[model samples]
Target: MTTLQILWFILIAVLWTAYLALEGFGLGAGMLMPFLTKSDRERGAVVKAIGPHWDGNEVWLLTAGGATFAAFPEWYATMFSGMYLALFLLLVALIVRICAIEWRKKINSDQWRARWDWAQSISAWVVPILLGVAFANLVQGMQIAVVKPSDPMTAVPVDQIDLAHDVHNLVGGFWSLITPFTLLGGIVVAALFLSHGALFLNLKLAGDLGDRAAKLAAPLSLASTGLTAVWALWAQFAYGSGQPLAWVPLAIAAVLLIVSTAATVTGKIRPAFWASFAGIAGAVAFIFTNMAPDVMRSAIDPAYSLTLWDASSSYGTLKLMTIVAVILVPIVLAYTVWSYYVFRAKISVDDVHPAGLLKDKIRLGENFLATN
Candidate 1:
């Protein structure tokens, strides 16, 4: 309702968009590990391509979640508590993903690396699918109800209660979340990330490996475009807010994805990668835009929905957070940009040794430090 509340909601959406755009390809590379790489050296090239950027990419997720907790405590509490199982699985998968990536090359054993490769591949799919499902649920509306602090299921703390005092609670548990539309959403994002990752591999690897990645990217991007088209239409017609504006971002997403697929087929890998990134970003924007005044919609009853005004923290808190964000966000952006620029060289299979480190450490070129 208030300008600051709306601004924070938009900021949170932007953070989530950044997370998917940056992390999607990294995880997608992991998803491709088992299928794309015939040899450990090739897999090592894949790993090196994503290694310097993955951890930094994850920071966006952390920031998004933290912002939600701080700026929209009620929304955060209800969503996290209601969707605990799915998020728990997501967390487990993330932990497994990190371990798989960090430890896979440490032992320098083929058997060891293979096991980790499968784990990473599985985790990679789970993360994006669950995330997509969760975000889709947000847009499609959940079984939410309004409850007072006396209610056991409601997650609001008494101390945080204020102007909008009613606590919003999710009615059903995990089973309620599984739906045909939501499943399609899961598939859509998984395909999107896979396409994004393949394009990334096309950019990052050299020789036959890069060409193979490019070859795979075309089909994956094509599939992503088709899947996204189906899912976007389904969402817009069924669960969308029915506003004319909602269709704009969805339309942009579809067009960008088509451009991405075309670029891949035409051998324009850089444009293909960027178009895929922009397409995903546009899709996320549509999701947020569709929500409008409500942060969490109620399928049980319209009156029970949680709006941005109902969920937002105090004005003073928002003011302070805005100040902090202004000071820190640019620093983070600068570091991310600088890091990527410094490590911007393509990694060849020859660069990776049996241990997955650089085959030769004596190189002092700017790209040489990417191994670090």
Candidate 2:
């Protein structure tokens, strides 16, 4: 692979890490609805805690996709076409979450808000699980075969695959996506998100709600750390290309989780929140680290694995993308940091219009906006 291809590959990994780190807690907030809050007002508090940044966090996902399409068209096409159902579900979950967040307040009825709240929670949970499965599939490799467009049925042996004409296709159906390892990954990811969300609540909530999330923070972080440790160790030995370098990020992620758990136990809310963020990013680091040299490994045959060289777009394309990304990415980062700084304050049940604030409720509907 050219230097540009390798650089773009690493850049894409960073984008994915940023998305998971930023969006994880928002998704976790949804997962915490049933456990952290008993009433709609409390639920509203949890939602509002993440309200300003959730949509912006989604931009990383789009940026990642665009980068892939531009820098590695073959990888993008193979992945999207192969994992259509799962990727479709990811989009559906995001859409449902957006709808639930925006429409929940329109009608101002208890039932309307309750239904949307449930939708948000369910979608939130599904998103992490699906993300886990997809990433795990990449780590473990899929049943992909290289074939010519004309003879899609017959497989081109990996040795004979013509990078110019033959295409890599995932022949296995949706059921093939499920396996013990992938299932473990799904649950572990959900656990991490739940823990991360609880940390966010601990950091951004006040009053009894904060206390409730605070109590959940330690146990959830501990449990998630344990689960991830198990999964990472297993993957390190089995699918990690037997490389010692993979262990570095896995260890860092595990240690961060431990630190997060301890920090939360000691009531260090901000540290715990940031620790959770970095921990998730570290875990993502391991996924890409272990899966490198081969972007998508072929379980059917080692030779069929798609490497950076095989999957990348032309050198010119990658160079152009790198230049554009260098220019635009910093702007996105600056905006994200600025928005977070502006919204960096705790939210409480009182900040929500109190539902009983009927005077303003009648005009604005029961929405997340505080009257100030």
Candidate 3:
């Protein structure tokens, strides 16, 4: 209700949106590495493109998580408790990805690095899926128990609480994590990332590899975008809120996806990249619009839905955080841009001289390609 609160909400939303858009590009770039880079030289370039910035880019997820915990403790508690398993999986993926990036060069044995390569690829695919699932569960609400923490003697146990039927709190399970809407979200994320990766390949790798990446990105993005369109429409019908804009972003994303794919297919790297960028921007916008006003909506009962009004932290905290963000966000963006600019050339095999973190990865990729 306060002006400060509204401003804080806007700041957090912007931060989250930017994070998804920026990181989404890297995720796409990483996934395309294997496909776009056919040789050791090209793969190195792909890795090098993302090397300096991946870690920094990932800070957005942390910022969003910490902000949510501080600003909306209640929503954080409810959603985390409900989606514990799914969140856990995402954490695992994050760890694998970080470790793979760091340890790829420590070992000389190609096989050893190959394991990390596999880990990198799997985690890359899973991160978007887990994120999509988590968001879907939040919007749809999950099966959760209403618990009061007043009368416990020592510690509250799961066994002691009444296991009641509350549809808004769904148990974060394998099936729930792979629901239709969530799967579509996952596909959208993956395809968009792959498209971004293709653009990155064009920017980072020079010759045949970049061309291969371009070829791969166009078809994959188109297929995934088509799937997303069908699922988005189905979601509107299945979880019909009768809100016209609920599914509008999906349509917009589809159009952007088509443009991006077409551009890639036609060997228009710059246009494809911009189109992919627009597609990603549209996807995030769609998500925000679909879940607007309410950070988390209920599939069962409208009364149980949690909104920005109900889930916010104290006004003082919001105001302070907003002030801090005003200074912090710009600095983050500046450094990010600087780093990318410094490393903006395509990587080549001749550049790999048996040193740095990518030595083992390059060798492994060579071996893997040779074997296949």
Q: Give me candidate 1's TM-score against the actual structure.
A: 0.91
Which candidate number would show the highest TM-score if scored against the true structure? 2
- For candidate 3, the per-residue lDDT at 306 reads 62
- Candidate number that wins on lDDT, 2 or 3: 2
Q: Compose the digit string of candidate 2's lDDT tens values, residues 249-339.
A: 9889888989988898898978988988999999999999899888888888878788888888887777778888889999999999999
Candidate 1 residue lDDT tens string, 223-333: 989998998888888888778999899889888999999999999999999999999999998898887778898887667778888888999999999999999999999
Clashing pairs in 2: none
CA RMSD of each candidate after superposition = 6.5, 4.4, 7.1
Model 2 residue 78 lDDT? Answer: 85
C-alpha RMSD in Å of predicted model 2 compared with the true structure: 4.4
The clash count of every prediction, one per candidate, is 0, 0, 9
Candidate 1 vs candidate 3, TM-score winner: 1
TM values, all candidates? 0.91, 0.94, 0.83
Give Cα-based local distance difference scores for all models.
0.88, 0.88, 0.66
Which ranges in model 1 have alpha carbons more than 4 Å from their true place? 153-165, 356-372
Cα TM-score of candidate 2: 0.94
